[model samples]
Target: MGIGNWELGIGNWELGIGNFFLVFLVFLVFLVFPIPPFPHTPYRGSS
Candidate 1:
């Protein structure tokens, strides 16, 4: 029982850290390659 509880605590800690790293990576990518504000159309001036 004691060993099982100790392992559960360790697993939870690792899971939390993994999720944090994933979120940080996504944020960095968005900051580096942001979407363009203007629309990319071939006929912007043509009507």
Candidate 2:
């Protein structure tokens, strides 16, 4: 039982890390190549 729980915990941790890296990569892509129309309006409004 204890070993099973530990294995499950490790699996969850790996999944969480994978998801976090995926999101980070997407964010970097958007930052590097932002959609012109999408960001223009918001930037103008904020500034």
* lDDT winner: 2
| Residue ranges of candidate 2 with Cα displaced over 4 Å | 1-11, 36-47
Angstrom error of the Cα, residue 8, model 2: value is: 13
lDDT of 1 by residue, 1-47 (tens): 33344455577877656665665675465467654763452334342
Worst 10 residues of 2 by lDDT: 1-10
Model 1, position 8: C-alpha lDDT score: 56
Whole-model lDDT values for every prediction: 0.54, 0.60
Q: How many residue pairs clash in each candidate?
A: 0, 0
| Residue 26 C-alpha lDDT in model 1 | 55
The TM-score obtained by model 2 is 0.48
The digit string of per-residue lDDT tens for model 2 on 1-47 reads: 33344555567988656666665775577677786767654334665
